[model samples]
Target: MTYALTNMRRVLRELRQERPADVPARLWRYAKPKLDVLGEEVLYRARLMGPLAARYRGPGIALMFHEIQSNVDDELRTGCSAGHLRQVIHAVRAAGRDIVTPDEALRRLGDRQSAPFALLTFDDAYADNRLNALPVLQELDVPMTLFVPTGMITREIDAWWLVLRAALRSRSEIALPPMERTFQCPDLASKTAALRQITAWVGTDQARAESLSETLGPLVSDPASLVARYAMDAKDLTQFAQHPLVTIGAHTKTHRFLSQLSDGEVLAEFTSNKNYLEALLGQPVEVLAYPYGTPGACGEREARLAREAGFKAAFTTRPGHLFPDHLKTPHLLPRIDIGYTPQRRSALFSRLSGFQRAMTTRWGAPVAVLD
Candidate 1:
């Protein structure tokens, strides 16, 4: 029932891109408090069954987080607050799971004698992670992997999503001739709707996306400063990389979706990002978390290219536990998103406990396999 409603919302969301005239209203109607209630109920049930669910000793879980801010309200909606981060850590530990590094988790992936554990990973190297998350993590003595998109560090480019959000915040409306639409951005809902529409189109064509963003620049008040406020500069990245508990990994150069590019383009994304990070940190970088990382954004080909570019492992946004089988296909590991609202802590735990993965797999969700 939860799965059906979730997929229904996903389908409605996709349909909204094509039929914006009606789907948005239906989506709002369908995706409101009722769906939230249903999700909460499901998580409640999963929590009740935690002990029984624990019996299926699968491989450890890799949890992915983006940003950790001092005050989550002031931060972008994409990230969780320091308080939430602590809660997640405490909850997982209380559930009898040890938090391990990616290296340790991978080493113990197929070892049945190994206790169930969780690996923490942060993507995009946001400065807030260093300021807020690092202290908390250090205090708790938890180690985490930080995936850096080298272009952002080098100031060669900004994340397009950040740029778009900043641009929308200052404007009431935006017109994109390429997309043949004018988006209303007078309120949060409209701004989010515009973001979804623009990102979907931009995710498909990199060149056109940049051109459109450039055209929309005047609408943004101080876009450059806005980006700098959120992203880590080269110096910040270098300093963070030297931290003993942080494992630096590649997250592509420009953060473009790999599946949209040609073979040469894909290879360049991995190799160049890897080379830049190695040169900066004075260490070999061996792991990758593909940007965008959805099925439409990354696939087996990108995973193979990541291997060819010399990465020991690659991760996707796919939600699952690290099974023994995943050891055979190291480059295509699955990770669960740990972003949570105040009410969804139980849901986050259900995902971390591997119960959600079991249910989804049993329901025939496609799991990636090595070629």
Candidate 2:
């Protein structure tokens, strides 16, 4: 208990300080496949339908992903890579579980008796989905949703994380071309502090910042060229939509946090992304995945906005299974974050178990607290 208290203190200290100098590495790459080659007891435990079935009273869990590409180099750098997609696919298949599609996942979430299931959903709509992730899923006959920020189609621009990377590099003499300074914190401590400060700002006001980025983005040197180099274009998206396993979902117009924005602003972000996707793909884009998807990123108000915006369902980063009561706000679907590294598996399973325990008891236990 004292150690837990001490750990909490340290976390609070860190949260109170500036952002991490390293930008906390946007996504972590798996150093190796998470599963044991010889197959360990963990795998055996994972296979047991009883513990999970008894532990998780709901229907099933759904997983969240961003980008999956063949280029390990790019993936390692971005933190959103699914380098072990095949390994993951094999594991899921061997487990003999169903890979539910987005529509089916939502429908079942609204049905308590629906079978145990999982669904794969990706965000950011990178070109690599078509080039890399699509083929494997197709081969496996797995259905997935590709949540795209439709505005990126015409303009090739880096995601905010990439922009932060570029900004970090600009401060270093890393042999990369110079980028326009977004915020100057001078030294590492200051940089971390700046990021922490900005993280709070983002949590509180991401929409304004996103809007500001757009006007100021062109002012950054080689804007068009940079966008071209990092993002998927309209042509790329059109090509991606051609796949049978790929269904389109909205990720807001520019991936702004809907909760931080005004009601109208939230509506604008949702409607814009939905309308843009519809116009681009010639179909209704009904599913939604909140940007960040974390608890603080958006909340009840935004969940209501998603339903009012005509989304049949929406998703969040909250890790758990879904049932009808869970879909009281059908738009606020909770998802599990599957990590690339083997080290993450234990933590993932632990978190899942903890979540199942908390749900069953309905105790207001704090799994974690900042301060």
Q: If scored against the real structure, what TM-score would every candidate get?
A: 0.84, 0.69
How many clashing residue pairs, candidate 2? 11
Best by lDDT: 1
Q: The CA-based lDDT of model 2 is what? A: 0.61
| Model 1: CA > 4 A from native | 1-29, 32-57, 193-208, 340-343, 358-362, 365-371
lDDT of 1 at 61: 76
TM-score of 2: 0.69
- The alpha-carbon deviation from the true structure for residue 201 of candidate 1, after best TM-score superposition, in angstroms, is 5.1
lDDT of 2 by residue, 120-194 (tens): 777777677677787788888888888888656656333554454344434522111222224543344334333
- Assess each prediction's global lDDT (C-alpha) against the native: 0.76, 0.61
- Considering summed lDDT, which 10 consecutive residues are worst modelled in model 1? 362-371
lDDT tens string, model 1, 1-371? Answer: 55345445555555667665887676676577466567646756655635544643355777888878665433325578888888888987887788987778877876878887888899988898899898989999898899998777876665666767777777787888878887765555556556666877776566766776687776777767765788788889889888898899999988886787899999999999999999988988999999867777888899889999999889998777777788778888888888544336557756766656555555343343421
